[model samples]
Target: MLRYGILFLSILFASSFDVSAAAISAIQSDLAVLRLCNASSPVSLQAVNSVLINRDMKSSETQTQDFKCFLLCLYVEYGWMDREGGFSLHHIKLTLESSKLPEYRIKKLIYSCTATEITDPCERAFNFTECFWSHSDKETSPEAEIPEKEVSDNQNGFYYIN
Candidate 1:
């Protein structure tokens, strides 16, 4: 029984680590996706491509600088500012509060770009119809949705043994 308890605890801890790793990976991938979208701009393309080609080059300083540059790029794209380099004037603030972002680079990104809310950048590319950012407030129904009425009609509806 004691060995079983120890094994269970180890499994639980391992699973938690996996979950945390997954969250970090998701955030990193989202950043990468945003970079790819802005690849048309010469400067943006270079910076983004550098990161893409050399994942091992991701150091604390590089991440900080890259994130800052990304925020600046967003500002430029949104017409919040005419030029780059000077990021202090932008309205949105993106702070590196989490441990995942060790070298904190806080700047206004959400509000300045007229982004009322933050979005997962990784998901933007999948939407073929329109710019995901434009319809931030719009709600999308699930594609494989089941009505609540149908669910309520069956006793064992929730179970799918097959």
Candidate 2:
């Protein structure tokens, strides 16, 4: 019984590590895309951190036009977003395939989450982002997501997952 318990615990930790590693990779990719979006007139650190950490803006932040536009800029930077304010199925599936999601589910998400009624570009992108972000999380095991590591001031103004 003792040997069996030891073996089981080791196997459990190994599988957990793999899931954690995949989650780290996803966050790193997101960080890269966010860096590019923040390049043109930087979004406030608070705004960026809130969206990244919370996955949704506070009501006040959403109401702020500039914050809404910042979210739009993030979509454009990701490349699936098009001029018409809708997501590109090809890009979403092929180019930016999210980690751990099967292709079929990704396709379904695109169909379900595509921006439709929202007239404002900012609102459209923000809504789609919220929808997509929430759905993507649903598909993955919650334990797989590693939260962003807290960091103090630095000249580079970037956060690392480590």
Candidates' C-alpha lDDT: 0.33, 0.58
RMSD of each: 20.5, 16.0
RMSD of 2: 16.0
Provide TM-scores for the models: 0.22, 0.55
Q: Candidate 2 — what's its lDDT?
A: 0.58
Write one digit per residue (lDDT tens) for candidate 2, span 75-117: 6776656444555445666754646576555655665566356
Best-fitting candidate, scored by TM-score: 2
Q: Tell me the spans in candidate 1 whose CA falls farther than 4 Å from its real position.
A: 1-17, 20-37, 42-84, 89-94, 100-162
lDDT of 1 by residue, 13-88 (tens): 5567756767666655554545443452223333334444443223443344334445445544433322322222
By lDDT, who's the top model here?
Answer: 2
Candidate 2: clashing residue pairs, number = 0
